[model samples]
Target: MALMTIPLIIFLFPLAYSPGPGNMFFAANGARFGFKSTLKANIGYHIATFIVTYLLGIGFGVGVSYSPTLMLIIRYVGVLYVVYIAWGLIRAGITKRNQSAKHASFIDGVVLLVLNPKAYIIIALMFSQFQPSTIDPQFYFIIGWISAVFTLNNMIAFFFWTVLGDKIVGLFRDKTKAHILNFILGSMLLVVAAWMAYN
Candidate 1:
């Protein structure tokens, strides 16, 4: 059990920190709105992540992993979302480069978690890496606790960006830079969604 800790920390931390739908949305929202207003979205996002992880940790993840029908649904939805977001980013970049439009709202963040295959995938991958063959098999419980820890790390990681975003936009008071940043962030979400679709 203790041996699994190091591997879990190393792998999960990087994966959590790296930009995904949640982080991208965090950046987009944080840039558009201040960190104070973004806390609600942050809580919502973490809750979604935890729910996804909890489901996957408890073996529900295999459904998405093996079911072709389910996988296809995820694929099409993800691709369509990616295309939509990509189009938004390009348009914002070209036309509304100076406007601070509220692109990703709270509902948008929650829906992204549902549509995000990466959330489930990460849970499945990390859960697979930990061995649960103890004599009493209590390792499963350990995994659950560790999953919470990962969730905490995610909160801090996102909070950091949200705070930094606050400073950046506050110092500049420039909508152009924020719009451009959001466009790039939206593009990143599109890439993530596309990658999830392809996978």
Candidate 2:
């Protein structure tokens, strides 16, 4: 198990650290509402990630197979959700003071995970690569360990992106520059949404 740690980290690094929807969502929220304010959403997301990944590791694929169109529905819904969040940020950027802007909630984080097809795909891929072919006494233990590691890796990546967003905005003392940052982040989210929809 110890020997698997390095390889697991290496396999997950790009997937977790890349500017995907989850990382971008946290970064945008962090830029708009600071790291402390985004903590609830952070916790919610990782919690869901761990739960969903563990379930999938332990034979949730049968359920998914029974619902053939479920993933398709999730993909489109996720696209719309991302677009909605991006529009909010874009609108906020247009205003001098976004008095109406609120930090993402715990529910929002859970919904995002529920709708995100990419997340499910990643979890499936992780199990495919790491899970043993035959079930044994250690199967449950291995699955739990993988799920925990996957959640921890994602948590760290999201935290880094969140802090990066906060620090980037902090570097600019001017409000206009801050607004520009919001626009950039929001636009990047739109791109991610498009990618999710088409791919």
Candidate 3:
């Protein structure tokens, strides 16, 4: 059980807490859309893992690394999207209107999972590092257990950020206040984008 916990934690750590495109996307979703909107994103993330994880498992990373160009494209796309999301987040936060929440849709969440380069690389690496043996019932058991962990962890983490976004956005009650928030978030996004692009 202890050994099982360590491997599970390794998988959980990168997915649940890393600062990749998925994290930024979910964080932005939380800020714009209520946690409910974030639900799809959280689900999409694991669905993606379900596809990639069970396929090549640990071997995917080696193949991905060979194609540096693909990584480059994904990295740049992530940077650009992050900037766009930052604008929306700022806008939602500053708007004084008592309008509906500011979350992206399920499709948005799906795309985020698709676009998130960090998630792919990290999960690929983790899969590569760990393996489920044919004879090992423990391996399959761990999968069921890990699935539960990822679900709960994402729900909690996504809610925390989304709630924070909702509250922050609530502060500005009008168009003027919204514009202010927009500017700040947009500017922050610009800086982050530059860092992503450069890095």
Candidate 4:
């Protein structure tokens, strides 16, 4: 288990750090609301992430994974949810006072993970690659460890993205520049939604 630590980190680093729905969501929220305001959402996201990933690792998610109909429903729902968030960001960008924009809530984070198809796929892939073939006394322990690590990695990545967003917004004192940045972030989210739907 000790030897696997470095490999696990290596495998998860790129996946966690790379821009995706989760990263973008945090980034946009961080830009609009600042890092401290986004803490609840971050906590909610990781809590859901750890639970879901652990369940998947233990074979609980296997049943859901096999159901194409359920998967399709989740995919479409996630796409729609993302679109909704994107619309909010775009709408906020049009307004002169960004303070009117509402920060993402804890429920929003949980729902994001619950509906996200990509999250399921990634967890499935991670378990397939890392889970031991033979069950043992330590099997559950190992799964829990992996799940914790994955959650931690994601937390760090999201924090970085959130800080990056805050920093970017901090650089621009002009409202126009801030609005443009919001527009771009919102557009990027829309593109991510499209990609999710298509893929």
Highest-TM-score candidate? 4
The lDDT ranking, best first, is 4, 2, 1, 3
Candidate 4 vs. true structure, TM-score: 0.94
State the displacement of the C-alpha of residue 139, model 4, in Å, after optimal TM-score superposition.
0.8
Across 68-176, the per-residue lDDT of candidate 3 in tens digits comes to 7987887788777877777666555444333465446666766665665655665555555555655365666655555455445655656665566667766655778
Per-residue alpha-carbon lDDT of model 2 for 49-151, expressed as tens digits? 9998888989976466236488778888999999998888876753222446677889888888888778887887888799867899999998999999999
What's each prediction's clash count? 0, 0, 13, 0
Native-referenced Cα lDDT, model 4: 0.86
State which candidate, 1 or 2, has the greater lDDT: 2
Instruction: Report how far residue 28 has shifted in candidate 3, in Å.
Output: 3.1
Q: Write the per-residue lDDT of candidate 4 for residues 1-199, one digit (tens) a residue.
A: 8788789889988888987889999998888778887898889999999999999888888976768898889989999999998888876643332556677789888998898888887888788789988899999999999999999999999999999987777765576776788788899899989988998
Looking at model 2, residue 32 earns an lDDT score of 75
Per-residue lDDT value at 1 in model 1: 52
Whole-model Cα lDDT per candidate?
0.68, 0.83, 0.60, 0.86
Using lDDT as the yardstick, the better of models 1 and 3 is: 1
Using TM-score as the measure, name the better of candidate 2 and candidate 4. Answer: 4
Give the root-mean-square deviation of each candidate in angstroms.
3.9, 2.3, 3.9, 1.8
Give, for candidate 3, the lowest lDDT window spanning 10 residues: 94-103
Q: Report the C-alpha displacement of residue 198, candidate 2, in angstroms.
A: 1.1
Worst 10 residues of 1 by lDDT: 93-102
Please name the candidate that would achieve the greatest lDDT relative to the true structure.
4
